[model samples]
Target: MSITFEINRGDLAKAITIALKFAGKERELPMLCGINLSIIKGQLTITGTDRFRLGLVRIRPIPETADGATNPDLDGPGSNIGVLPRATATRLLRVIGGPLDGRSPNVELTSSGRELTVADGETRLTVTLVDEKFPDVVGILLDEMERPIDLDLWGVNTALFAAFKDAAWRKGDHATVRLSTASRPAVVRIGDHFIGCLMPVQIAKRGSTASDWKEFLTSEPERPTRTTKRASRAAK
Candidate 1:
């Protein structure tokens, strides 16, 4: 059966941007590397994961009428699902998603057989879909990966590394900082001097070395590297 629907570019693009972060980058889990778009119970859910981190967002797609009423055309309550490969997601985001604002037109998405197409009723992009099935992330999160949980391991945003470097440079041209290995808000220090604290990003392991997710959503945190990136550079 061919499943078809329309979604606001702004909403869909924003959701895809967040989901891309969780999408698998490695080939180890080829199936988990793509973005999953599914509609269930009148809600559109977009998800992406790399076995280490999972991100999903639900949207009850509805349109606002002149009288402030809701448009029932895409008010969820429908079934249409597809997986956009990493490359495809990137391309789609770059194409229709770029410069997207609330006024951006709605995009039509059609999934038929092994193909998925995204267009705005004029120019269209039709690509082949992945064969792998997306896992029930909501179910997994409800049980296996519960909220308000504590673990030794934590994820850090790679972007913050620059700030750490900037702080060290500001302190001294070649200041050597000691980063404390903690679960959240990793403390950055320069000798006995405290620099700042950075929150944990969505990381799988606390260690520098790669570790498998023991059982899907579970992992044993490993000891962090003795020397941080900037520290090692200063030592050299």
Candidate 2:
């Protein structure tokens, strides 16, 4: 069955922007070079991964039409996975997602069989699905994790990217930053809205990576405490 829905352009852009960090560029596997756009139930999920790092963003439910009728073309509460070209999707969103007539633009995505169509106002694009299956990005993000840490999503992104850049300079292009996850895959969360994971690269690990994290926590006291502080207080 075909699925069709309208999405806020700003939301779509944010998802795409985050996904681009993990989306493969000029890769052999076509599926690896695209973002996986899925709508399960009413939630819209965007995921991208290069097997080393993965990013997932879930937007709140897309709105129904003013008359309160669910689009009949939807395929119920199953996943509608569409692998879209990252570069093309990014460009499309940038052009059409900006303010339209001084108001936010909303773009419609229609999936029928193997093709996905995107349209905003007079601009429309029909992209054929890559003839490959997208890897399970969410599953990879959740797997092999000993601890989940709460951090600002933007902070994680900035620190990791900087670390990645530094590692590449000192080590090689295949370098990785050690996420402070107790010798396991590092998973980070920002409330319920976002989650990201990065695999550890095999190399001599660095020390004192926790100092920046400590400072981050000190600055933001509302972050969920990993330990039972209340229990400790009662014991004391």
Candidate 3:
């Protein structure tokens, strides 16, 4: 079946911006330097991942229709996945303008095997799909995780985001944000829609408290105050 669909440029751009966090950077794996766009169950899913982190956004497009049925032009069965160069995709989305534009731009995507064409009005962008298989980003994301701390999306994005950066500075790189019952400091966890593990900037050393030191100091019996007979004899 032919793979072609038109999506609201503004909506597509918003989704891309959300997923761009996972897009890989230069000097990284070429396959990771692209965004994976796929159609599954009538939803267009865009995913970007640098292996360490993943970002995904799903959009259900409904073209203007007289009847309240799904847009046949954008709806189809089965799954079709394609990788688009991140740079090209980003540029294309940016050109589409925001949702508040005087005229809503429509971006058309048509796929032929390894080539996917993106067209917006008169402008068009064609990007080659990467051959390398993308790692299971979803699996990594949904893998067995401690129950996440539920918080408002805005709070996490704003307050928690700044806190994470500050912690990274004090704790150094690769600090882990451990989520566990034993963790005294509150660890923020959101719903399934958004999950993030930030490396902790600083972690208190376990068993380093003054009370712990006092317990250790008093736990052991005092070393025998009496000197050994052999030492005493030597001294004599």
Candidate 4:
């Protein structure tokens, strides 16, 4: 069955976020690498994972009436809305971000011979899915242990990105950012490697309220208590 689905900015953003995180770099099984989109129980679930970090997003669709129902199938608005592999979804999102008729921003999905075609206006991307089964990703997400620390999201994100960018110039595959609570420090690792450290930045203020000023600093490598002169000189 052929159907049309309207894609808004929110949906596009969510799709892109999941796709970027899960798209496979290896060329073995290409189809298992795409984001799977399924509509159920009034919620659209987008899932993507590289067997390490699985990203899932549940989005509510815009209010629209389908032809087959008495009240309305608000949950699954379109028929046969199959999965779009990661590569296809990424390209589709890029096209959607470009110049388009805002009033009629629609993505057409057509499945033929094990391939799915994602089209936005004149641009189209086709992706083939491998027959291999997708692993049970949802269960893993559900089983994650609760984090102990309460994070300052805005502060942490800003500090973390800044720390990563600063560490880019360092010579090595390993780079990390570490943040500490009053009691302990948080560490950031890149690709099974430790790179750098980050400290929480506190803002200072005057008047009736008291405050303190703090900033995240990039430091030299964590040195051994007893280090060779060559290593010490290189760090300096």
Candidate 5:
């Protein structure tokens, strides 16, 4: 069976919200490093984790096709969604995050077995799945001890990125910044007021590319915020 779905910016935004969190973990098996998207009982479940934290989001698909006629050029009509490797999937989402007009573009996801491809009009992203089963993330999430605290999502991201970048210049094993939740939410004091959220971390690639790093840094609050002590390793 095949499926053709027209994804709008809102839908794409929500998917990225879920996908980025799942991609922020250390993977014992390389394939577990990607987000898993599966259609179950008429809803789409997106799951991600880095062993310490796990993020699971359920999304309902909007029917973008009519008359049962497959978009032919697009995957035909059905409910078969695909799993995209975290890095590639993250990148794919960024490319489509702009206006839905042709410039920003829409992406088409297709999968068979462990291989997944994300296509944007003429651009294509192909990734080979890591040949290992993702660990049971839900179980780990259930065992966590801390009660979830509410923080300003955008504020926290801005502060974290600034802290991570500032720590990059320091020489040490630990760098810590304590955010006070007394006045306004912690994240807003720093910047990034557009998207408010807490996300998990999954990938560990280093880079100076503005787009890539910016997207990766601010995608989720689930990613561990590294202080000077832990940040030193990444600095070198």
Candidate 6:
């Protein structure tokens, strides 16, 4: 069967933007440099990950027809997974004009084997899908995320937190990260539809943080045992 689904043009633009965050850099992994697009049981999902960070967005399709009918174009079973090149995603977002475009039309995405066609009105983008098997996002984003993080310090690459940058929803939406332990990857969640994971650095000296993650919060924060006033007085 063919893979054809209807999604709001604006929403698709945002999804592409969010997915691009986790995409691999050029030459890092040729296959992973694109957004992993998958349709499971007719539900579409967009994913990007470079091992260090992972981002996933599920684009809820526009509701079916008023009379209730499935997409006629998807009558036969075919490949439900495809990879959209990162360059294609960015260009498409430009074509879509972000999430707040005045014309929020329905975008049709049709994929057959390694070919994908994205069409909205007279604008059409045809590209060859990346030939690669994407990491199992479903398996990665699983129960490990549910584990609550109980620790005084959970050190992760701050860069990983920026996964939410220019996210489809907003530039910086509050995210809740749960890191069970340094050995495991931390769950980074932003809102409902968007979720990801950030792995903590190995703990060398501390057996928790691989690097020397100094606690800047220290140094007499509240009572201030060593105050600037004291330093000035001693200087005199």
Compare the candidates by lDDT and give the number of the best one: 6
lDDT of 1 by residue, 49-92 (tens): 66545556565554553345555564446553767889998888
Could you estimate the TM-score for every candidate?
Answer: 0.56, 0.65, 0.58, 0.48, 0.45, 0.75
Best model number under TM-score: 6
Q: Model 4: how far is 49 from its true place, Å?
A: 0.9
Those runs of model 5 whose alpha carbons end farther than 4 Å from true positions after fitting are: 1-6, 27-32, 66-83, 103-107, 120-123, 137-236
Global lDDT for candidate 4?
0.47
- Tell me which of candidates 2 and 6 scores higher on lDDT: 6
Q: Per-candidate RMSD vs. true structure?
A: 13.7, 14.9, 11.9, 12.2, 15.5, 6.4
In model 3, state the lDDT of residue 79: 63
lDDT of 3: 0.58
Candidates by lDDT, descending order: 6, 2, 1, 3, 4, 5
Q: Report the Cα lDDT for residue 221, model 4.
A: 54
**Residue 26 in model 6: lDDT:** 69
State how far residue 29 of model 4 sits from its true place (Å): 5.3
lDDT of 4 by residue, 1-236 (tens): 43334444445554456345544455576545776655545555555555433445555544542332233343555322445666567766666566556534545445454566666566677776445555554443323322355433313336334434322223564544333332233344444211222333443331222121132244455756666987789889
Clashing pairs in 2: none
Put down candidate 5 lDDT per residue, 99-133, tens digits, no spaces.
66654334555565666665556666666655556
Tens digit of lDDT per residue, candidate 2, span 1-236? 67777777777776777677677776787788978888754668877777666666776545564346554434366585677787777766667665667543667777888788877657788877666788866556546444455332222334444423321212333432334444445664544555667654443334435456676657756766556888698789
lDDT of 6 by residue, 116-212 (tens): 7877766787778888888887778787766666665566676776655545376556777676765788777777678787777765456544243
| Candidate 4 residue-pair clash tally | 10
Q: Per-residue lDDT of 1-236 in model 3, one digit per residue for the tens? A: 45766777766776676566657776468778878877755778877766545555677665652234345554546464667778877776666655545543667777778887777666677777767677665555444254465421111234334433322212344433434323222332332222344322332464454455566667866786666986798789
**Model 6 stretches with alpha carbons more than 4 Å out:** 65-79, 98-104, 146-152, 168-173, 207-236
